[model samples]
Target: MTGQLRAAIYARFSTDMQRDASIEDQIRSCREYAARQGLKVVETYSDRAVSGASLMRSGMQKLLRDGRSGLFDVVISEGLDRLSRNQADIAQIYQSLLFAEVMIETVSEGAISEMHIGLKGTMNALFLKDLAVKTHRGLKGRALAGKSAGGLTYGYSAVHQITPNGDPIRGDRTINNGEAAVVRRIFQDYAKGISPKKIAEALNVEGIPGPQGGEWGASTIHGNRERGTGIINNSAYIGRQIWNRLRYVKDPATGKRVSRLNPESDWVITEVPDLRIIDDALWEKVRTRQGALKSKETGVPVWDRRRPRTLFSGLMECGCCGAGFSKVQKDSFGCSAARNKGKAICTNMTTIKQKDLEARVLDALAHHLMDPEAVTAFCEAYTAERNRLASAATSTRTTLEKDLATTKRDHGKLVDAIIAGVPADQVKDKMIALDARRKELEGQLAQADSSAAPVRLHPKMSETYRERVAALIRGLADSEGMEEAREAIRGLIEKIVLTPRADGSGLTVDLHGALASLLLLATGAPVHRIARMAAGGQNDKSSAGAELQGVDMIDKSVLVAGAGFEPAAFRL
Candidate 1:
């Protein structure tokens, strides 16, 4: 707080070919810069083989979350593009960090301002788009030349061409007889009347490895047929190659690539006689059978058997293996990994009935609110904290207004003196100096107004927190408000860790989130005071030690102590 500024270092590289030492090199440069500026490097974050086009990278998310939590005074990165390549994402990140009073310093741009975010962000975004276009064009050329455009396929080995400079250039692929024999068997068996499921089972029985060195499943033999991904369905096996049958684009919500079918007009079909494994006669027979099977299914009457949506679809996780808990049956949720594979894959085979889990969560909430004294203490602490933040914003606004008045008044006097009969050059020089100072003051005032403290819960909101929480819990029992109630629970609870009982009868539920923080505040310790003590490098454990008891305590003690008291989760 006094001498050295605390800095969090962020580094990123976009491709796997880049050495792992890239992160270290970036951090080393940042450390040198920090030392020159008299800053203390407190933490470091990095993302490897991650595209900067999005902010979905794990390290970037952690950096932003920590920034909001006020964990450090400044963030240092090698460049603005190292943080993000998307212009909109750059702007959002800049505003959020600025509002939190944390400065972002880059080695290339120095301390980032709105101007840097705008100009550098646009440049980075353009770079990404141009690079994508060039890469696509190169791949398209390779495909048209009957060469391997991407990774090696299942039944082939890559053929490399050595340049005069002794550098090997990857081009075409040659058949791998060992894997090609297996591929031929899959096509022959499927064409001879064996189902894909039976073929997979036969391969597994023979101890044959699947494409990726794993046990084969029916889906592996019959992948997205339109995209030419499956072993038997691929046209490359029959003297023809299909390229660009599908294209991948990033999903906005998850930032993961989702494949969509490209029109047949866009596909590049090439004749590669050397790559053929199956004869045209066999391929035609297999295609005819597949068409027949599809036609039969298309004629069958479809049943309206859509399953009802569950309340805790994405919230549950297994305590044993840390795998997601998915709805395995109509009324039960089980370990997804175990259910998808076999019980042998995962040791924890516990299943929880949906009704039981819901009841326990509601019961726990009711029990926690039963104590009036604890509720009163939390409400009072939360209300006072909100008022304090609002008061700070008001005070800062008042000071900026006073400074603006004085700057304007001095500017007017300087202008009047210039008009009166003073030497033109001398008066103009004075006036220019005054005008520059006035503009600086105005900029400062605008920033102060724009960076007003974040909105927090008022007294009125806190007073009704108990009733709203109770109503939400009770509403979970009704079918009508189940969706709203589910969201309410998720807002209050970060995750519901269900540790299976040793006896295998039930689960021990552990709650985490803003409500858990209330356990610490019930003892009358203010969150801001604890945060201040923490910021000053002082340890304060008395609050949590006295109030939070037993083994059900949530993780991240600092987060619990510093989180604001807002009832947004309790709102219906």
Candidate 2:
């Protein structure tokens, strides 16, 4: 009644658990606890029906932001499980609050960080790990059980079924009569030589709302032109569901990254009795044409980008939208979607020849970065450095884990004594002191694992011997392939900014950030300027420049020796 209190309460429930449990109940419990402690209650945060395991939780992000801003001195929750079901997520949030000097009070668990409290924290972390696994298992089971585990797909609906004994159940259904009619027309139209945009326009002209009740876009039209799902390419119009045309996998290890062509054993198929979107013959024609179209103009296949090709799509970044530019000619490239809709979003389209940019970039990387031998040496050095730190990290983690275990055992004894009617103030002081020590140990353990022992590598050129220096420089100059180039680029050069380096009219290379970071750092020398630098005493820029390295490292200005080289048309 006398003073104001500021508290933020957080609650979460994953997708599996019926519905998100009561935030009101959590808040009420928190409010009562705050009242008992004569503390004020200020703000509340809730993420209704969102997984705590997800990295992009907006509710948790907002809570951390407000907490760091000092809008709340304390955060109350039902338990650690409600706040997060992921250990890493919980740890990150815990660190945020600890750094911001906020107190975390759990109504049921009391305060944090006694040997017992810390043990409970570990248990809470374990609970989340187990919860994430359990939730995934349940979902996979539901999906395997021929249930609609997710939303109604673009062309299908949920149907009711009855067993032979007459009990009813919900089942995944066939294409909707209305949507199926639309699907057949789209495939037939495409095979008859209609473009995707034309198909989209025709659909819009007829006023068919797209899958989600929006005006049809090219992407929507393109995506729905699939086969076998009977949504797009139903081989079944001639009567058959090609049950397993394609499959995909979501790998959990790397955050559920999708992979194509999961094995046939993984598919589930139930044929519709009297439904078909497109006939087998038409499906075959569409598939053949689509394959041909793709082979003619290839994109980077969905594989690892560890070995980057000098593809125009990889090198050219749009100055306006920051999207990578796509190739227009074998010589030059422009934006893929710059003026997508009547020059609407972006009207500016810039093009640059491939050979001109590639040569200079390769040379610049060579001059700045180390080559293959140096990278191998560096990798060896880096591995040793990491192992040294890893050893120390392991040692420190082991000690804290032991301490945490001991503290938990002690906490159990304290709880038992309290429950048996121990005196309040006497037991309370001991619990608080134990909690504080546990928290301090935790801080030390976190700091050790985070910043850890330093990697020993002298940045000073003088400290490095002449052999090492030669190896380093030569590594950049003679890096045999793209991997060495990329390594040297990542290590020495900060960023490679591309612009019209020759008098702002022609393209050239500039390595700025890491060049400055690594002194003896290589900087760009546009041909006009380099010629002047080379002429020793002559003003080469006024008269333009002369060819030196030909098209290998210098621009056409240098290749032509004051006369621009004849532009050659390259067949892609």
Model 1, 1-572: lDDT tens per residue? 48677999999999977898999999999999899888999999999989888888899999889998888999999999989998888988887786567999998889887668879989988998899899888888888998877777788988868889987776679999999998888888989988776777677767788888877766678665556777867888877877888888987765778988899999888888999888888888878777666535344211112234666556577777677777778898877645443343445677889988777766555444324544445456645654665587678668767766886788788677777866678766556656765676677677656544432323343325446557666767789876565555544444556667888777766544434333433333344433332232212232222233321222233112122433322210
Model 2 compared with the native: what TM-score?
0.55
Q: Which prediction has the highest lDDT against the true structure?
A: 1
Model 2 per-residue lDDT tens digits across residues 1-572: 55566778876665644354577777788888889877777888877777655545677779899998989888888887666655555666676786566877888777654343456557866876686578556655555555544455555666878989987664456668887777777778767777555666666666787778855544554443332332334444443433333544434343343536546665545444455566678777777655544433454221211223442234345555454455556667665445221133333455677766655554544333433344344335445656765785788678787876786678678878988998766688777766765776677777666555433433233223223334544554554643443333333322333443335564444432221212222222222233223233222222221221111111211111111221221111
* TM-score for each predicted model, relative to the true structure: 0.60, 0.55
lDDT of 2 at 161: 84
Q: Please estimate how well model 1 matches the true structure, expressed as its whole-model Cα lDDT.
A: 0.68
Pairs with backbone N, CA or C atoms under 3 Å apart (clashes), candidate 1:
none
lDDT of 1 at 249: 90
Stretches of candidate 2 off by over 4 Å are 1-6, 13-21, 65-71, 95-101, 112-147, 157-182, 189-262, 273-275, 290-308, 311-315, 319-322, 338-350, 358-482, 490-572
| Candidate 2 local lDDT, residue 84 | 69
